[model samples]
Target: MTVADVQLFVTSAVGGAMVGETVEGIARYPINLRYPQSWRDSPQALRQLPILTPMKQQITLADVADVKVSTGPSMLKTENARPTSWIYIDARDRDMVSVVHDLQKAIAEKVQLKPGTSVAFSGQFELLERANHKLKLMVPMTLMIIFVLLYLAFRRVGEALLIISSVPFALVGGIWLLWWMGFHLSVATGTGFIALAGVAAEFGVVMLMYLRHAIEAEPSLNNPQTFSEQKLDEALYHGRGPARAPESDDGGGDYRWSAADSVWNGSRFRGDEPDCRADDWRHDHRAFAIAVYYPGGI
Candidate 1:
């Protein structure tokens, strides 16, 4: 017999058997097996079974078929309707970035994928990468908005640029505090930094306004008001702008703006030298330090 004839005969004998008898539907009842055709149950027994082909010849099932024991996957997984395998990492002491980096390096060095095969990273690493990409687009936009608003408020490019420069200083404290609290460089941390930068710009604007108001409220620049450093200090102490001085838990005020002494003393309204420059250096340096130091207190 041919392979096809033998295959069909063996398939009918082994798999196509059906012995039927009536059983209980709702109430219990006895049912007897009408035809118990259990001869083709085992593979080893089926090998000895004889098959009658179309050529009127009898042959054993083993003449056409090869049967053996083997092992295969018990379960399979898929992604997007295509077969896939997953590798998971459980990080305890290691950071996600370094782990993912090392894994990718190892994969590139040791594993050779066939054509049409690909690999991708997901979970927290993927989320972080996406957040960083968004920050790359959003951070510059945020800074530009701050710059434009500062320029509009101050009506001077130099002043706006100065205030904007304080932004990085404002973020330092937030970043340090987040790290101390076991927070990584995430989207939430980045958002906090952006908000803090705005606050820094607000501080700069308020300080500038204080100086402007004090100068405007003083006697005219051409009139030349005579005042010593002590009087100028008093003016700065009392003539602060709309922003109230930050008070400690003990109700004392912080003297962060005390560096304004040189600025008040060297003002044109105070009738100092036209060439005299205020301690601009002191303002930026102190503001940066304050910005970096204050968030922890909050």
Candidate 2:
């Protein structure tokens, strides 16, 4: 691990769990070969052997020697790589330190060189990680609050949940759009995402609110019409079985009558039918109308 140590960092990687974040395979070749001092003077002489330098320049190893590369006939004839060979020499005396230094330089020269080793995770990384966790947690909780708000505001659980679920696509789109704009999501972007969640829900909420009403408003022969209590009882009984004359309008003139076989619903002001008492019609019609129109007290 000192200046006298010659290491060959071997260098390719396929894939692994951390494959995307890390240099595929962390590799290094360490050797202790030393050469005659004569080869240091001439670039041609240096290039003559299996030495591979990133740039072909004369190198001195008073305390450290440089790595060189050869991709010519001599190296090919030497049965190195098909047409190239990687070469390095050791500088004696505490060569480990020098070797590490030279290796650093070598890595700098190799384009797209992935790091071969790791010391430890950085504090910045940990900080960002904690931020990420908080953001993840906040996303769901914020969504939950929005859902609750929707429920309270709309007075219907189904429509509220639907609005909350719709926010994810908005979130995803915001993320992608930010990426397209080259905005690395930092603290500011995290805040923006929260805002986007609310905004996104509005998209669904606006539509959802209107949609529920539209659906509810659909004609229902089942839907009850309001009527005066006088005919209300009459309508209820006659509904069970028909044939009843319309009573005095109660002076209200609101005696529009629709009969369900079981009940007059809103009007049964007066009549002679079994169980067809006036009370039955008025009570059932009002109750049924209330149940249908604003059920859930909505």
User: lDDT: which candidate is best?
Assistant: 1
**Model 2, 32: alpha-carbon shift in Å?**
57
Query: Candidate 2 lDDT (Cα, whole model)?
Result: 0.43
TM-score of 2: 0.32
RMSD of each: 15.3, 27.2
The per-residue C-alpha lDDT of model 1 at residue 251 equals 14
What overall lDDT goes with each candidate model? 0.58, 0.43
lDDT of 2 by residue, 166-240 (tens): 555445544544444443445455665576567545544544443344434444422577434444334333332
TM-score of each: 0.55, 0.32
Lowest summed lDDT over 10 consecutive residues: which window, candidate 2?
Answer: 9-18
Clashes of each: 0, 39
Off by over 4 Å in 1: 1-75, 78-82, 110-116, 220-233, 239-242, 245-298
Deviating ranges (above 4 Å) for candidate 2: 1-123, 215-298
lDDT of 1 by residue, 87-157 (tens): 78777655577788998999999999999798888898898788889989988998899999998887989
Candidate 1: residue pairs that collide:
none
